[model samples]
Target: MKKYIPLLFGDTRSIVGVGLRACPKRATTIGSCPYVRMRSLKYSIWVLIMGLMTFFTTPASAALDIEITRGVVRSIPIAIVPFDVNNPNNPNDIARIISNDLNHSGQFQVMPQSRLPQQPHDADAVSADLWKTLGLDDLVIGSATLTDNGQTKADMTLLDLFHSNQSTPTVLMRQSYTVANSQTRALAHHISDIIYEKLTGEKGVFSTRLAYVTVEPLPNNPRHKRYSLMISDVDGHNAKPLLTSTQPIMSPDWSPDGRSVAYVSFETKLPQIFTSDVATGQRRLISSFAGINGAPSFSPDSRSLAVALSMGRTNPNIYIIDLGSGRLTQLTDDAAINTEPSWAPDGQSLLFTSDRGGAPQIYSIDLAGRQVHRVTYLGAYNASAMYLPGSSTKISLLHRDDRGFNIAIYDLQSGTMQTLTQGGYIESPSPAPNGRMIVYSTNVGGRRMLGMVSSNGQVNIRLPEVSGDAQAPAWSPY
Candidate 1:
């Protein structure tokens, strides 16, 4: 008899087994039947011990397991040489930032800086043979120089080692930028954009920003929690509070131009829509309708806002408020709850969450047609639908299944739904400006933190704040 045991890890699968054969009835003195039985028993015991060890050694709830549900089969291989800086105390590690951005995308594997045989500041100095010896597909080298005008001048060159035919590597891209000392980080992100686009043929979102809500316990007032609206780089750096309130702040949406944000705040003991300019620290109340005023989303044109307002009704309806005139036009007049309105990339339609069908589901309403059509049917619960960047055919949203609320993407063209996360509690999915990644909130050991997932359900990342809870991430447009 033969017994087989299967082991599974990611997409990898293997089997371990031992065959037990009856000992020969007539055995020579050199090879006894008793010896055969003892050997078979030892093999069986060894297999059992190994299987138990594997089962116990595997982390059941590892963060990387988030992609076990679905992950990119292949990630691009690239190297980022340490950027040559005129001063050791420059305080800006541009190459590291670029490397982190590409790594976080889960689409590229960056070679470690220590593994490089030499540091090259430009294409002229890059040793094609040395890097090629390491078998890297791509290589990036750059330099940052301090200018007499107190600004920084940065130059980056990307080399395609795969295309190199001679001692010199092929130049895939080369770019130069001048920015103030304070904006050096932004310059690095722009360089990442150039590298990502040249390699993936899709726009990169490394230069984009993220807007999220953070909550912390107030000292001397244990009963009250301070809610803050935070703006930061996509990697969770340079976090600054846009507004802080004792009350809650919810549903943040970035303006089309990425200069301002619209969100629902409870500053006046009631939910109201407010828009704040990122540069000027200016804020304006956009909606204070009689009933609920929530889920404010900016129109693509930036001239109007699509919001959910109850208007003293039993259920909230979709409304479009002209930012200039404050004119309000109701888009949905249903008695059922219609909220969480997000605009299409074209701004001609809106996708919102509604409970008209007895289940919370997503629906679409064309501004001109005024016809509401159901968009989700996979699960009994679906909400928070937003269009992926540079895509109208797909949207990332919250979905509920047996596990709980998780992030999932719905293909409008294929009518197929695929989940991207496995957290027990997950919500508020905001896609990156380039539409290749998503950031959402998840419950991690009773505390709320941010998580990111690639659009293809690969590359899961967690962003946990050191002192507070982060939720409702809204990615800025490039």
Candidate 2:
């Protein structure tokens, strides 16, 4: 196996042992995955490693805000010292992306240590008074060194300033990863994962990937458009286009294994269901059903796709197709426009939008022909339902109010709902891999911009914009 530091992700990098080469514009390929066969052994070892990392620190990465009137209400201020590279292969490595990730989480107040009153190498340094004066709660010192065997390892540590009563406990964490120079950004993401969980208590989705659509205006007329299907990192790093066309692309949902994505593309001048390989960028039409073949969603098993297809069937219906066998089964057959289908947490039932009553509202249905029920009674117009991915039971929808469209969450049990986004013409609410946040698109200053919202609707911010208006945000499973 070859060893290299991969830097394909301009802003993100990772060092990995050979056999993990770039599939080109895709994710790392753990070839033959020798470890796949040793499932139990891998699980045991991963559990042990993560357990140790947890003991050293707790980072609060959840979307829910904690009312810490007494304890630690303010984030533990931490200084992220630029990694001391023995010999940095890339002279232009910027920690900006990683810093942005930490700040976006809102759990850590990061201060650049290069300007610290007193800089220290490890946790045991003589800078307590300086950090306190600067209102810093902790410090992080990290460095990278290439081993003799032609591999790179980044070592990082966390230091907590001992306050009188509100002092943070000493939590130390170290993680070592290998790369082929091409993966430096990925390596940095690994460091982010460690620091995020260490300080936030919740696992960091920093290492996770993202799927989105990039829109460009035509040369002659700005009103007309061109859109490209893109997938990249959660921090908008390493973006690679999946498909480009003159029409709009929507609903890019990743499969369970992160191997493929099910989305609706209009390359043929009409909406159609398509699946593309995450590793190969290969695409295939899964459904071009006569009329309204759009909004494709994957089942929990990834074996089937619950698609909104009309097939000239009066109202848009929910149909399931076995991806492996191409066996199509109709899940809903109604004339009231049953569309925007999303599977339940347990995969036993599906939640979707319907007007079987009067206005568009959310409804639930089972495949066994058991029964169908209405889920959402709030909001006169609700469409495009998306369930929070990764072990979440709450479902989200694109809700239309007197004030443009905002994202809202529905609790099936209490029948309570939380309106997440406000005052932004928001749409396409796709949950991040960690389930703590959702990435969506909203009109900002009359321009469409990508925005992320905390699951509980606390932290809301827009991502960097592209040349044109952006819409249809999707978070990747990986």
Candidate 3:
């Protein structure tokens, strides 16, 4: 038996070790490689297979710094007043959190605290004429009080300032919440969601969660890195590690119910699929196949997983494993590489990547009749495809063009593709539940960080890490 050391770098693979190269523009195959028996792997796997040599144990934090690079030309102007708090020592800023959440969505232009004309905790105290002079359309006023029962009570009122022929602002919505003091941030996010929905007519993702992989070098050992699977709020707060290891973790997919996450881990020096409970740290082994086990995606019902497995073969295939019975059903069996399975909204079919057509492209496979059909033809390379929320006629995928690898939206109805990102280093594009925005990993200044782009290409935001590199962001379903 020959041992292989994993190297992280370019597309070149040698006999000494297996290299987790960056996303290549063209298809590649490993010919007669002893370490990795698979014939070919997609660029999604390339973005996934990082340094797998050694593991070091250390704590890693992924506090994200958000920077908006691009925004819409005409965003809704809104004001969020500083909430009046009874306890001055309380650290949570409910108003600030709501302001940041609305601003980051790219649909609203939030007024700065210093620019606000006045601070009012009640809608009746607000001057509609003064806000109309400031050219604001909406106003949010709230108060958070620490009650005597060791709980926090929050009140929020959304006021519409631009009502037709109305001198006084109309109250659109009013809500109250009572939660533990520690959950004040969550309450704030809920309030933001309510305000957004009342104004935009679409559901807001402020209360959703994000799951990603964060890697950092160990304190004592710079040569080894610590990889951790983390879960955080949509705004990148309350980040807590679900699992941390010296090995690499990749391709995290949240369950539709948001109870568990399925991912590939190399803790045992080989790839294996596991699902960890989001609330608790309990993990259950899903796949331990001999040759390869990667790219685990949850079914719509969350009772099954569509995973890529080699099964001691030279080429990988798609398989469906029942979570209850552990029964494995082969979906595709061929010499061509099939991986990166994404379940359809109805769960009757799946979209996967395969090179059977000479280049990597998105293909659909029906589970009932085992029928396969090619979906994309405009691009020479298209992989990592998933259907956008609420729309089956379109998909979001990583497309390679003359400009390099970027995020693109493909329309199945018109057979056209629209590239979203200009930077060629983008990968692992994950769409939010509402299909208004997407979050993915990109290389910025030679460091991997998370970024977001609105569905219409009007906004771009970078979630730069404070310390480590973040990748493979999975947006949780609300």
Candidate 4:
């Protein structure tokens, strides 16, 4: 008989044959173990659930370096002139922020700063002919000046170079904002959202936030590590810790209104669920069940949470907890592991991972009827499923195939699957609000880093951490 040992390096599915035992009564040090091929499908799922309890802690920094691994073949060509500033040495460049925002979306190709024919802060000073000659469709010009009240005044105008047989560019839009110096970055992201919507007709996620877990070894004691739940801008800037502890934090899911974040914390040396306010550091205990209290997902209304609980049993079942009354409603009672509950956009039903069919797969249960049905059949292992924004028929999930575990999009109607990332070690995929991109944690050079991939599989961007590993990224809603 093979002895069950825990693997403590990366995501649950990516590392094959290795798994962690679930519902430990005390906090114990987790270490790497030799590969033990899974014997049965139930055992495979048991391994996956147990792995969720294994966390490798890192330090407390939010600065991430971005690298674009893939790009779209054809992107819209545009140029953003360096905004004129009274203090030329100012570090916050509004124009540069907008440029990076658009470029990172894989929808726009921004012109290099050195290639611009001219730099104009005002719309009237721009020569449309010069830009048209360079085969550009759109141009953005802006200026930022410091006000006497210690506020920054920024102005921007969007100009269309290809205005139907006209030599003069059409003024698409003009806007201005006067805010505190500290809010200049926020203003830039807001402006980027406007420009992106005006051009693409879809709302931009530039102003959204992301909630994730970060950990690093302690300074005095190399053996102990600090774990923190961090919130940062979508671009991975202005990161601040919401909660920090020596214990493990895992599986952060943002509320639809973007006010609270629900996550699993092992601070008491036992697993518990708590919700923390994004603006305030205030926390409210959600669950402290007997055996296992893990995988907390907020419903669409943000009033209740769908979670997985063992309830002092060996295998976990799905349950819902009302945030107001503390009422518990059990959804699944079975011998198989039913975890990773993701709510549909409507909140009338939930999609969860289960091994009832002898293998892990995506399954859905209606709340009113308590009916269970399998949703994914294309793969033997499909978990961590979430409804892709703007479409109920499609879902983004973790799929395991011959290439190893990767992010994939599964269509419920046609039964088709489209793999997004080529990397075998990818997990915890959270789709952007606009359905344009999916952010997930990936293993790079043996370090867990945050990465994003376009829904169509054209673009892949890696957000590498400055110090230790960043895992379990949950993209906030707009």
The best candidate by TM-score is 4
- Candidate No. with top lDDT: 4
Worst 10 residues of 2 by lDDT: 2-11
Q: Per-prediction count of colliding residue pairs?
A: 0, 40, 0, 4
lDDT of 2 by residue, 183-206 (tens): 777877777777777655567888
Model 3: runs farther than 4 Å from truth? 1-65, 86-91, 164-166
Prediction 3 global C-alpha lDDT: 0.80
TM-score of model number 2:
0.77
Full-model lDDT for every candidate: 0.78, 0.66, 0.80, 0.81
- Tens-digit lDDT track of model 3 for 351-417: 9999999999999999999999999987799999999997988899999999899999999999989
RMSD of 3: 15.7
lDDT string for model 4 (268-373, tens) is: 9899999999998899998998988999999998899999999899999999999899999999999999999999999999999999999999999999999999
Per-prediction TM-score: 0.83, 0.77, 0.85, 0.85
Q: Specify the poorest-scoring 10-residue window by lDDT in model 3.
A: 50-59
- Which parts of model 1 are misplaced by more than 4 Å? 1-73, 85-91, 147-149, 464-466
**2 or 4, which is superior by TM-score?**
4
Clashes by residue pair, model 4: 58-215, 58-216, 59-215, 59-216
